[model samples]
Target: MRIHTLDLRFQGIPGLIASYLVESGGEFALIETGPGSTLAALRSAIRAVDVDESAIKKVFVTHIHLDHAGAAGWWAQQGATVYCHPNAARHLIDSSKLIDSARLIYAEKMDSLWGDMLPAPAERLIVLQDNEGVPLGEVEINAWDTPGHARHHHAFVLGDVCFTGDVAGMRLEHSSYLSVTASPPQFDPVAYVQSVDRLMAAKFKTLYLTHFGAVSDVAAHLANYRQRITEVYERVAAGFREGISTEENRRRYAAAEHQAAMQAGVSEELWLKGESANVTSMCADGVRLYCEKQP
Candidate 1:
């Protein structure tokens, strides 16, 4: 199986988001369609490899998040089967709720940020359960329920390579800084840790993150991600306990993340760009919600 990492050049920033094209025995499958705004970029990337967008008959998404599967409906509309976790299937079949929630957060910047989210046809939306495998030509793509960043998240596996969606967090290439992508409404720290444990137990040789690209250091990456999730969650919980406001917590988290990136040899410009791509404020909001729900 050959995996091609397609850089969507989201917001004209390289390494911010990626979509994967898997080729096996002349058959093609797509993982992560990025946002609708980058549809043209994705098409260009695919054509760069001499493969037509219509040749992709299968589309797998790690989750229903805009950056991951925003253009999935477009693929399905082109006659490709859209596969996702059962929890995420309904949302894709009817994206009204998802779009409304995102609109509330992004408001007027919605179109530029994520573009339009179209609902995938119900008949074309294939829901995969945990441990189920979908045949993609010679290789089979397996789906594992790896909820953490979102309740509907899944980590797709092919042989020893795992396409870890946001459940594995965000880590840019050449930078040792790994930030926990805790977004609101469904970011459960405990569940996230458990999902990491699940991934660790699988012992995959390589991990392909949708945020960026491949990670060959699977063991070290997962371990560090698990530890970071714990550290950030505890810090947010402590801040809430100390009566810190959500905005203050976000400021503190962003500052700490910037320092970590700097210590890891990331340039200030790149760090700022990454911060803009994956806003740390959402991380604070996610952790705060998790803390509030605790007994």
Candidate 2:
């Protein structure tokens, strides 16, 4: 199987988001659809490679985040099969709750941040069970229940590569620094760490992340990712103990992370882009929600 990454140019940033196109024996599958805002770019990219966008028979996403599977409905409208976790199948097929949830996060900027998300036809939706395998040409794509970034999240193990959505955290192409993506309502730090450990225990040659590109150093990247997620939660937890507002906690968390990135020698350019892709404001809500759920 040959895998190619297409830059969605999210929020006008080239490497902030990516969608993978996998082909085997003339059959093609699109892993992540990015957001509806980049549906046109995705089509143009596929066409530039001489493959018709409509020829993608199987469309799979690691999760239902706008940055991951936001454009699945658009592809389904084009005659493609949309596959996602059963927990999220209804949301994607209807998308009324999806849009409503986005309103909570993006507010008036929802449309600007992530264009329209039309419902995927109900007949085209396929729900994936954990550990179930679906044929992707010559390879069998296996799904793992990875519920850290979201309860409905799944990581696909295809041949030698693992298409880990937010379960593996964020890292852009230009730099090697790993950032957390603790988005609102469903972020679980304990589960996030365990999921990273699970990915490490699984035998995979490389990890293809939705936030950006692929990472060959699987062990090193995941170890650092687990440690960082813990640290970010501890930092946020301290703010909660102090009785600080969520907004104030987010401010402190972002500043601390920015300083740590500077000390670690991450470039200013990618740091800015990476943060925009997964900001502390969202992470703050995620941490707070998890903290409240804890004893």
Candidate 3:
């Protein structure tokens, strides 16, 4: 199987958003579709690999976040099957609720930020359950229910490589380090940690992160993700306990995250872009979820 990295540039961030294409047998599979506006990039990626756009047989979205599964309906229209965790199936089949919620968040910039996020026809949507196996010729991907970032998340294992949507967080191209950004309302620190532990137990050495490209030394990456995410969550949770406001937490965490990325040698521009591109907002959401779940 051949895995191609498709960087969906400037979808929201100048260089942060991305997706992946995996081709096996005579057909192709897309692990994530970036966003609705990323249709051109997706086609470009397939063409770069010499695969016809119509040959894309399946699209396995780890979750329904706009940046991950936004272009699925488009792919389905192109004759591809859309597969996702059960909870996310409804959103894919009827995106009205999801679009409405996103509208409230993005307000005037919805189309520019995400493009037209239409629903995939129900007939084309395939709901994947945990432990389900999807065979793409000689290679097979077993979807594991990996939640935390979102309840409707899945981590796919294909041979030695694991396609971890946000389960693995963001690891940029040039950086030798990894960072964690747990977004809110859907971010569950405890669940995220548990999910990481589950991934670690899978014993795969190479992890395919959605942010940019591949990361080997899975132990090191997961360690850093867990350690940093834990620290950031602790800081945010403490702030919440002390009656600190959500906006204040967002501001402070954003600064700390940016500095850490800089120290890791990310370019000043990419660092700033990654820090601000809904990452901190998601972190704030994660912190809020943690606080709400606290007894």
Candidate 4:
């Protein structure tokens, strides 16, 4: 089995998002279809590798987040079976509700940021329950119900490697700084931490992050990510406890993130790319909302 990491070059920025193409027994299975805005890039990447679109018979998404599975329907239209968590299946079949909710968050930039989300045929959309496995030629892709990044999130395991969507957080290649991508409406720090623990217990030899690329040091990477999640959640939680306004909290969070990135020796260019990919404001809002619901 071979896994190819296809960089989507989101917003023309490399390392911001990726899609993994797994090959086994001459058949291809794709994991993650970066937002529709980068559909052209994905096609180009596939062609560059000399694989036809029809060769990709199965498409597995970690979640239905625009950045992760926005272009899934496009692949389904090409005759691929789209696999996702049960909670995310209906949304992919009829993306109106999904688009509406995303518009509320992205507002005017929605079109340029994510592009149009084409809905897959209901028959083409296959919902995978927790612990279900899908056969792809000689290999089996196992799905684990790994939530916290979003309730609809799943981490797929292929042998010893795990494809962790957003549940594992965002880590730019070569950067030691790992940022939490706790987006709004479903970000639960408690569940997020638990999901991280679950991944840790599984002890995968490598992790394929949808945000960027592969991580070989699974244990350390996950340990660091788990710590970063708590740090971020506490930072936002503290701000709410102190009665700080959401905007102020966002500013402080962004500033702290900048400082941390600099301290970690992340280049200004890479830091900016990471910031654009996972906005600190959204992270702050997610944590703040989680805190608000607490007694």
Writing each residue's lDDT as its tens digit, candidate 2 over 149-206 gives 9999999888778999889888866355778889888988888888888898986799
- Kindly give the stretch of ten consecutive residues in candidate 3 with the minimal lDDT sum: 9-18
- Which ten residues in a row are the worst by lDDT in model 4? 167-176
Model 4 TM-score is: 0.98
What's model 1's lDDT at 222?
A: 92
- What's the lDDT for residue 86 in model 3? 93
Question: lDDT of each prediction vs. the true structure?
Answer: 0.90, 0.86, 0.80, 0.91
lDDT, residue 213, model 3: 70
The sequence of per-residue lDDT tens digits that candidate 1 reaches over residues 108-136 is 99999898788889989899999999998
lDDT of 4 by residue, 1-295 (tens): 9899999999889988999999998889999999999999999999999999878889999999899999999999988999999999889989998899989988999999999799999889889898899988799999999888899999999888999999888897768999899878799888999999999998999999988799988899999999998999888888898999989999999999999989999888888889889998998888888899999
lDDT of 3 at 246: 72
- Clash pairs, model 2 backbone: none
lDDT (C-alpha) at residue 139 in model 4 = 95
Model 1 compared with the native: what TM-score? 0.98
Once fitted onto the true fold, the runs of candidate 1 whose alpha carbons sit more than 4 angstroms away are none
TM-score of each: 0.98, 0.96, 0.94, 0.98
- Residue-level lDDT of model 3, residues 112-156, one tens digit each, is 878877778888888888989889978988898998888999988
Model 4: residues with Cα > 4 Å off, grouped in runs: none
